[model samples]
Target: MALEAGTVVVDAAVTQAEPSSPQARTERFAWGPVLCLWVLLTGWSLLRVPIPGVNEPHYLGKARHWWNPDWCPGDFFLDSSNPHLVYYATFGSLTQWLAFDQAAFAGRAIGLLIVALGWQRLSQSLTGRRWDGVLALPVFLTLHATGNFSGEWLVGGTESKVPAYGFLFWAIGNLLIGRLLPAGALAGLAVSFHPLVGLWGVIAGAIATAGVLLQRRRRHDLQPTETTYSLVNIAAAVGLGVLLALPGLIPALQTLEGGDPQLEHAATQLQVAERLSHHLDPMRFPKTAYWFAGSLLAIWLLLLRDFPNDSRQRWWRWFVLSAVFIAVVGIAIGFGPRPMAQMPGFGWRSSLLKFYPFRLGDLILPVAVSLAAVQAVMSWTQQPSASVSKKSLLTAGLVACVIGAISIPFPDQNPSRLSPREQEDWIAACHWLRDHTERTAQVYATDVGWAIKWFAERPEYVNYKDVPQDAKSLVEWNQRLWKIARWRIAVMADGQVTPEELADLKQQTGLYALLVGRFGPVKAKPAYANENYRVYVLP
Candidate 1:
């Protein structure tokens, strides 16, 4: 009998029999120890300092805005422009109902929950051993740590790449299990969270669909029932995504009144330079010599002759293609532009930029580490063979472990955390603003607008940008207060705002309150200091 592509052609006559009871079948699926281990691993990963990077504060602020029902007047549809508003609103509502810290802890909790769910799905897909899910925990933690360190020097949290990856993984797992519609919906949600992740989902879906179609064609088996199920799944995914996106799409379409000529020119110039840079950088070659070498070795040792015989080989091929695609995108972008070069003390921008298309080469690091662990597990499972010396296999596995150990430690370099004192000081400053300012008062803070907007219960003038024209009057009013008071309550890094600017700001606002950081100097005395932050109330 000809076997199907995915089916394992086992010798059923010699195979062990299934248990005779319904309970036995149910019990087979419950792996308590594995689940426990997975939970423990997840906890360990989350405990690593909350890496505040890549639009994290913005999302938190947006969530806070959503929680305040009285806010966002006149523009109901404009609220949807913030991609994370839905996620934040949902979490914030729950936190508000429970009287929890809606700004800080609640946002982190939701992120953790999403990651955990994603990991669970990934583990189920890869090993069918729920415990193996813990293996991928390090990937999430390491990326967050890296982001935290990087955030110190640049605008880090503008994108939710980590969370996006989690959703993408979940969608892919669902797709593999033949739940097409749910997978598509999950993939759609991932895209809504971060558009780049949606690319991965598309790739995975296309691959799976193509594989299924090819299998059907080769077998000359036209099974209408199975085909119908697959088609339904695909349709469901598309339909669900469209439904969810309708809210955002409609508003976006209405908002496209006209394009700015200056912006159009700048975009065209940037695109030309981006293309040119890709050609000049040898280091930005699509294939990393090191990764290519390792992949070749893996194929030679494990998959060279076994492709047609092993189902696992097909999965491996899919993974390889995905990784390669991600790598190519990263290389292209890494060589593209030095957009963040103007920022002070952040020369490492180029290195971090490489992660844009999921950092194809960096992804190999996790895959390599996981493979080592898998090999170790397989070695432990197999019985001793006189012909195949267990000692050699054990030594090889240890060497792989050492390589992974070395790799993981290096990636953890420059882990950053705000001291408890700093946290307390920042919190106090925010609270002071909350108590002093009117609920509807718009605050024009420099860097910490999002933090203050959410934490201090005031309307932020603008987030991560200078106050727009719509709020120009509010900014001028704040400036007047600073000038009269000889103090300015502005979030500043070491040299971000000059003494002259501070003096001018004081002259402009007539108020004396300035929040300064290591990035800049402050003209006013710090009323409060923390390990990672300082607050100066202008006298």
Candidate 2:
């Protein structure tokens, strides 16, 4: 008579005659549609962007370095403290056999496929309809692409988080169907891939579990429609989850320890205020972010208005509300007792904000809206009292077509975030450096972003985009940036660099070569010249 939490209580005789149980529906699940969805998702994510998309270099570059430390030997960021050892250990080996670009393409393909399959199953579990995934996929993509409070993206790019999210989705699907052990295992694997992402999923699952227990308690006095899970079941779920999460969780926690409080405080300030302001500081978000928040509110309102509450779906409600609660807490902290907008000093405020509270909401809110919208439509269509009209159907069809057309993935014109001519020149310069320069040579390229070490296969003095996570390294990285800033200011003052200035720059920074913009005048003759950039040898 007693059932574990999340287990559906089915009447055997009636369900055997109708074959309408959740298990029966799952047994009839078809893979053909899931495969088709996977292909669509692949095209949209992998084929839509060029190899080495935004974070590919950031993550893949580190992956390569982890496998072969000799690679970019003196690069500070690559050699800095690593908190994602599990990700490196899992994916870094690909660099041994394939080129960086090839490995990136392969990783993207694999990650996208996993995400598609997981999403399809998650959709089916929520609605108990196979085709609901097909209908909701485009909606999820639209809402996700529109805008978000934090700069978090689930799809696109080859990174640890992509596969982590895929596993998280699968865990949610399992949790919905009362498979706690499997859910815990999958969620644990998610944590191993990306601790922050996996932890969010774990937290959401915990919230759902609590909701299940409370709902069961509420119904205890009434006719026992469902029985509460034994304490053993709860402990088992938590124990399995912790066992699986330790690999990633331990490293992530270690990163927070053994840091100078003053230095860590400064690092947090730099992260929240300067380096990652767009992601960490809510006040730095653009108008589009606020608009997206309003759209999410509207979606929530519509779901409430259209759908009546169902006890079976209580877990889903609590799961989504957890994300909303996190975002609300983030907004409150962002504009709180002292207000981060005023550039509050280093303290608990900056420390808490640095962990990125809005990230989970960015992904979860859109997912909730997408599923709720489709479910509402299905409910309306099934209503016996509601009469459907041809004109209304036609209007709905038109709207769906418009949404589908907009969701079509197109190749980016500037995939590298550079113009074609500029990109060509940049690659040429990198290739030249790879062949002509020494492997251990230190090169400083102005505004090269994340690709210099990836392409040139050499160490860099410092990169603005690739900051180290540890406090001591971060402080050192900031010093290098200040050093670069001072040199650039002095050299660019006279619209030219004098011999004395070049000598001082070399002595101050110990540079073997300097790559500067083509328009910037230099006192010495360039070693190599391209239309967009010039590589200079430091005296």
Error of 1 at 176 (Å): 1.9
How much lDDT does candidate 1 score?
0.43
- Angstrom error of the Cα, residue 37, model 2: value is 2.5
lDDT of 2 by residue, 75-100 (tens): 88898877787777777778878999
Q: Ten consecutive residues with minimal summed lDDT in candidate 1?
A: 7-16
Candidate 2 residue pairs that clash: none
Which residue runs of candidate 1 sit more than 4 Å off their true CA positions? 1-38, 50-56, 69-80, 98-114, 128-130, 135-164, 207-233, 244-258, 264-316, 333-356, 359-376, 384-424, 440-450, 454-512, 517-539
Model 2 scores a C-alpha lDDT of 0.72
Off by over 4 Å in 2: 1-24, 27-29, 215-234, 336-346, 380-415
lDDT of 1 by residue, 1-539 (tens): 00111111111100111234211222132345345434543344334323443234445545545676555221112133444444554544553554333334444554555655665665554444554555434433343233221122111222244455556666655544444556566666766565534544455445534454455357644322223244344455667865654443343333322355444333232322232224223243345444543553354345234223222323434554555555555445444334433333322333334224444334433443353344345445454642356656655654554344334542213222335566566667677766765455444443343345445655543343212111223234334334433433443434355656655654554434555455455555555656655655443
